[model samples]
Target: MHGKRVLLIVSGGIAAYKSLELIRLLTQAGCGVRCVLTEGGAQFVTPLSLQALSGEPVHTTLWSLTDESEMGHIALSRSADLVVVCPASADILARMAQGLASDIATTLLLATDTPVLVAPAMNVRMWQHAATRANMATLRDRGIHVVGPDDGIMACNEFGPGRLAEPPVILATIASLLAREPVPQDLAGRHALVTAGPTHEPIDPVRYIANRSSGRQGYAIAAALSARGAGVTLVSGPVSLPAPPGVALVPVETASDMLAACEAALPADIAVLAAAVGDWRVTHPGTAKLKKRPGQPAAPLSLTVNPDILASLSAPGPRRPALVIGFAAETEDLLANAADKRRRKGCDWIVANDVSLPGDGSPGVMGGDRNQVHLVTADGTEAWPSLDKREVADRLAARIAAHLAPHSLIRNSP
Candidate 1:
């Protein structure tokens, strides 16, 4: 952990002040701290202050005479082992997602090939907006790690999200990133099947019913599996996300489409049903828009149940993977519901998550970033501590990959 190089990107947000304390923590941990402050970020913190705390000259300008003596922006950006964005404001996130680099901070972020860890800070309302939510999902799909915008009182005094995580948590998180030991290529010849996004049920030709699933978690799992040298088949619902590298992606709109795609890509080593498949779909979608009439209001639409993908695949079927896993999103009696779902679905494992109020902005869960889930199986259930979605994916993927090991998993197979 010592001597690990970290470049901290401090953007303009009320949480900029926390970067100072984070620098102290990182330096004390024997890690080198180099900082770059955005123009808007300079409002709350200065280059001189960050430089003093970091014990190195802060790169505050995109075009600096002394720093760019030999190689210019690209070299400067790729020099670090990792780039950490603390107090990553809403504007900075948007800029990063849009590939806009008009300033020093955004320039380095765009130019670097190194992985980035972002700790977001903004108003709860802005954080909850659909656009911001989409941007975050985009970043995570690209393997960008996110720390937190933990729940608490913000600088504006509102009690909600948009709070940057504390310095200690940020430091530990950076250390964790550096400690990544991706699973080996033991699964090189193996195949993985993943499902993601919300299944849209057609109500009419123009409109459809869907959930708030951003497809972040499923995409993350696909990426993680690919990194471990497995052939990945990603069956995604209607989502605006780029497919991960080395993945065979089949984009589908509705649950029926997704099921068909999954069935076609069968006989895999593992199957993870992460998509939030709709339980019901419109019985008969109107061919054209039904205009509102005075006497007879819009007729109540009939509904029909959809196929259960997890159970269908796991019921000793022709395409049943070696390990079939399901996800249970419950508001109450989490373990019980997940356990029941696991037994009924005939899946080997069930990842149970409590999607009550939005989580404290960790990543990969749903709606919000952080996720507290239960890993349930016929043997028993174990509660996973609340962690960012990235950590959860990495850990869970490793477990799935290890299940292919003959000795450790053969006798324990459910």
Candidate 2:
């Protein structure tokens, strides 16, 4: 990163303030920073401020007579090792998706072939809007990298994702992308199956049982596996996250659906069951909404055990994956329970974490980005320090690669 050059595009939104910090981090890391500020972005932060931090002229217009005389936009676009869109507003994303060159920022984006990354920031509604979703999907399909719009409350007083990711997270992503080597082909001929999010067990048409899983970890794992040249199929439960690029997505609702999907994806080289599947479901769910009785105690509902997806996939059979991994999300006895679960479920490994709420009552790993997990295997347990979910995914994928290397396993085992 020391000699890297970054073209930073600042777009509108309250998150535009974060771009300043990002610039500082980039420069302090010895990277050359050049900024292109959109008109909407100027409303949140001034060009002078960006210039002060970048130690360079901030380009805010496409029609500068002196600047265009030297084809500045083209230079700026091609000069960087990477291009990052911080607080990528809905408007800019749409423009990029539609190939709109109406502004200098989009014009540069359109002209450059440099690797691009976007951190979206908008109202939660806008972020979830069908149009925005489509645009993001299109961008991802075109090979653009997306960091995050973390889940949280926003300046608009609305909650449930759309906040710009913290500067450190964005910076780490940038570092990962910039320092990345040629895509590793260690798992090129292999196939991977990954499960994510929380299963929704319906008690009625209007009510359901679920857990607080944002699906970030699972999605990151899928992305990591794909990056390592493995074909990935992600069987996802109900989650707000977008599908990772290069991974096939099979969305399901209940535990049974997820199990069916996983079985259908059989013969995989690896399987990582990261979904927080419900242990039980209503024995007999009501066909319609269950009405409340006037001033009476609530009706008791019966529950039955759901299918054990992990155990089913881990069964000893020719079609079983060479390596099956399960996740143990526990509140107590993290290692003890995780080790027992690995043995009982017959999985090759267990990734365990304590999802209990912190003493300060802040959000925990269930819905947060960072995690501290222990890798439990037949030999021993290795505790990993807290890290971003993507980092965790990279480390886990690397371990899988090592485990599957030639001579690591008996490929012909029954």
Among all candidates shown, the one with the greatest TM-score: 1
TM-score of 1: 0.86
Worst ten in a row by lDDT for model 2? 405-414
Per-residue alpha-carbon lDDT of candidate 2 for residues 197-250, written as tens digits (9 for 90 to 100): 999999999999999887878888999899898889999999866788789999
lDDT for model 2 comes to 0.89
TM-score for all models, in order of appearance: 0.86, 0.73
Local distance difference test values of all predictions, in order = 0.83, 0.89
In model 1, the clashing pairs are 12-41, 362-369, 362-370, 363-369
Query: How many clashes does each candidate structure show, in the order listed?
Result: 4, 0
Candidate 1 on 132-245: residue-level lDDT in tens?
987886787677888777879876778877788888999888998888774576566678899998999989888898887877778888888777777899999988788888
CA shift at 179, candidate 1, in angstroms?
A: 3.0
